[model samples]
Target: MYIRKKKNTSGSISIQIIKKIKGKSKVIESIGCSKDPDKIERLLKKAHKRIKELEPTLFDSVKQEEQKLKFLPISNEQVIPIGDELFFGAIFDRIFNKKTIFQSVYKANDKHELFKALVISRILYPGSKLYLSDYLFYFKKKEISDEAIYRLVDSLYKDEVKQRIEEAVYKDTLAKVGGKIAVCFYDVTTLFFESESEDDLRRIGFSKEGKLARPQIQLGLFTTLQGYPLSYEVYHGKKYEGHTLLEALLNFQKKFKLKNKPIVVADRGMLNDANIAFLENNGYKYILGAKIKMLPSGIKDKIINLTFIDDNVTHEINIHKTITYKQDKQKHSLDISQRLILTYSSQRAKKDKYLREKALDKLKAKIEYSTNLTKNDLKLSHYAKYLDIVDDCKVEFRLNHNKVLQDSKLDGLKGYLTNDTTLSHKDIIEHYQNLWHIEKAFRISKTDLQIRPIHHRLEHRIKAHILISFVAYAIYKEFEIKTREIKKEYQISYKILRDLIKHVFAIKFDDGEIFPIKLSEVQQKFYDALHS
Candidate 1:
């Protein structure tokens, strides 16, 4: 049946709902002439509903769906969560199975599903593999031994399986969010171990979180400008972070088969003269954070003298013309094409001076009390250069006010370096500023993925543990993309989203039909958003 419009004698119009049966055209219903099209559409809907009610057999599906549009009244409603071990896992599995190519990369085996269960368990509650099975067995009633998980992770380390997974994830991310792998933001972080002694992989290094004297492993993470996980590497605890950049990036460039000259953004720690040359040689462009305070005396004087333009929020940042420098280093000596950008903020200056003075005050107390001064105590005091130490005879010190005043000149300014001279200073500044994407990614990995406190001593197992979290993180990223930004409207925190998936249980009655319990209003909104 369809709508029909007819013209009358007075040039008036009439609309009717018509049904064609075999060869006959019959008027199912008719409405008098109306100027409004919306009124006619409402009449059409009412006519269709009446027809469906009169002929229920022809519209059973529609009737049932209509009933679902409102709540389905159940005489005997029982919410049974026992059947699915975790509805949450089922939701995670959908994201996991759809977004990643893990299954195709590795052959399916007897314990393949169990391997996935470990990943889901980690997302649900991150903890040791040794105790995961116990909780799964008693609380979850899903039994997979910890040794099986150990052996599975052991297999991941064999034959470059972890590398294969990383490769597969890279391919999947590109396919999902299509473009060449461009604009990568890189950063390094340290993860400490709980063990008392140090090993080769987990030697004591400078901890990012200040877990001093603890055995820690450094993790170098790479991500897109949008903070999606791309690739990561684990290095020896005491290994210089500046040295890891060349290897990690070269391996990534080689393995992922990224095309020529993708832009790499990194912080100052990753911006050494050698690494810069390596990047330039490899046909990769980089926008790197620069230690302006540590710059050569000549360049420092030049940069701090530039006039800042803080007129508009969009145009407030100042950018200088391209700055070229001569590097007469032992290994890397060439006329480098570089740009130095200086950014200033009144707020940052206050914070910077406040922190420097705070550290100086702490050093004053330490010099008075610390009888046994060591290298570390000296390192903690940033103003130690200004101190007149007469500790050979007795612990005594005097502060050099001149040096303190000199250091205050560079309080508000920050610097960045980029080799891509083609881009405007604004573009380079914007790209460098997006380094926070990788920073946020590290925060999620460390806090949400709990990629720290190496619970496993075996190197392969440790690698596998990171891989599992990596895959979980990929799923999380896809989820965030789908959900977009609706926290204000939905208040859908991870806990809420997890609970919504976890508590989505069903009841199966005698007729062998499953009925998911009614969702709360907010839950329904989230469900719609997830699917939408």
Candidate 2:
């Protein structure tokens, strides 16, 4: 076997171990590929070492076997447990230590180590604080007491740790996206607790997960267009989702002191007169999802009557109105002009029609099966608007054909409200569509990082928990981006990558020397991508 440096079309060098048989060279193994001179030298050294290991001599093999037998016996008691100290732990350390601002925020050695452990554990194996010590000891062989963990959590809540981290993320993300943010996305979700009792911070409110009886906290997150989180705030559980927009945006602007105002894009849940007026009054531009059904009668009629030549076509309407809202029990009014963009999609229309038909079928089935219909029945059904009741000592129900026809007329239609006239209607619609990135961020936090069902009772600890999850998510997103950029040919999902990390472990001998086991082709690709 021989080491060969092959040049590629991209001006990079690939170091591989090759063998010659009958004048044809066969690649035995690929060490690595890189364009940097220092990395190439390193790869060359690795190639030499790999060659020696792969082509061991007879005496070297016997010696190695003897050494293994001497050190590790074939008995269960004598076997040392392999821990995941190489791949999973090392990748996290490399990413966290190099890419994140936590190193600057956390100075003390114990605090830094504990914080690292907490974040890593939260990403790999999310659990309660009591199990963290055990998890570390088993998986990483690092010992950290529960007391130390709680103490770090307490300290994190103080000293403006959360704010500092936010600043760090903002600067990092700002540098990432060409040092400017033209558009941003905002969304809120509920994180419920497992407990029944309510505290000042965690109270019974509208649960997005349908756990209305359980206490929860509202999390408002601001992310870049690509879904990299910038800032977040935890609000009172019962706070109105619409009311959070102004507070969160103002705080984000004040903290970051941004020179350029980024256009905010949100869903219909954040659509309100006060928010629209606030966005316009604060010198900020926005693209908000418009409530087409609630628009003025004239505007609604115009939107409904518009014709679409194709699914990609959109119509724009200029709206001028005065918005009045009460603040501090005083009435205030603001006049604003905005553009409403309406678009049609065949796919959306099909889904909408399917849902409407399904609801009507269910409603009709309920009315047909029941002997007597009460007011409560109609009150609970969302399709109640399409039904009318006549009471004369007995209740008779009739489907409102007019309302059904009106609703069908608006099918396949969607609206977006924007104040930025320079942008095309298509651009506004596209910006609003990117709002799903924030939704995906929330999903990652809740499902992958297990940000909900918080176990901590103390408010500070709860905040600290969220901060840790936020940091973990940042790292996770970085890893995801790197994976895509580095390995364009093969894509790895986070779930599968997580599983591979969990299984990629290392064995430590009695002499305190650790060696990672051989990795499969896929795992090697992931490892290389991570390192790259």
Q: Which candidate is the best by lDDT?
A: 2
Which run of 10 residues does model 2 get worst, by summed lDDT? 74-83
TM agreement with the true structure for every prediction: 0.78, 0.78
The 0-to-1 C-alpha lDDT of every candidate, in the order given, reads 0.70, 0.80
Tens digits of lDDT, candidate 2, 204-323: 988899998999999999999988888888898999899999899989898999899999998989998888877887899999888887787798889888998779898999999999
RMSD of 1: 6.9
Q: Candidate 1: minimum summed lDDT over ten consecutive residues — where?
A: 311-320
**Mind giving the per-residue lDDT tens digits that candidate 1 earns over 135-205?**
36533556776576676778776545566567666766776657566688888888888886887788887
What is the total number of backbone clashes in candidate 1?
Answer: 0
Candidate 1 residue 431 Cα shift, in angstroms, is 1.6
Where does candidate 1 clash, by residue pair? none
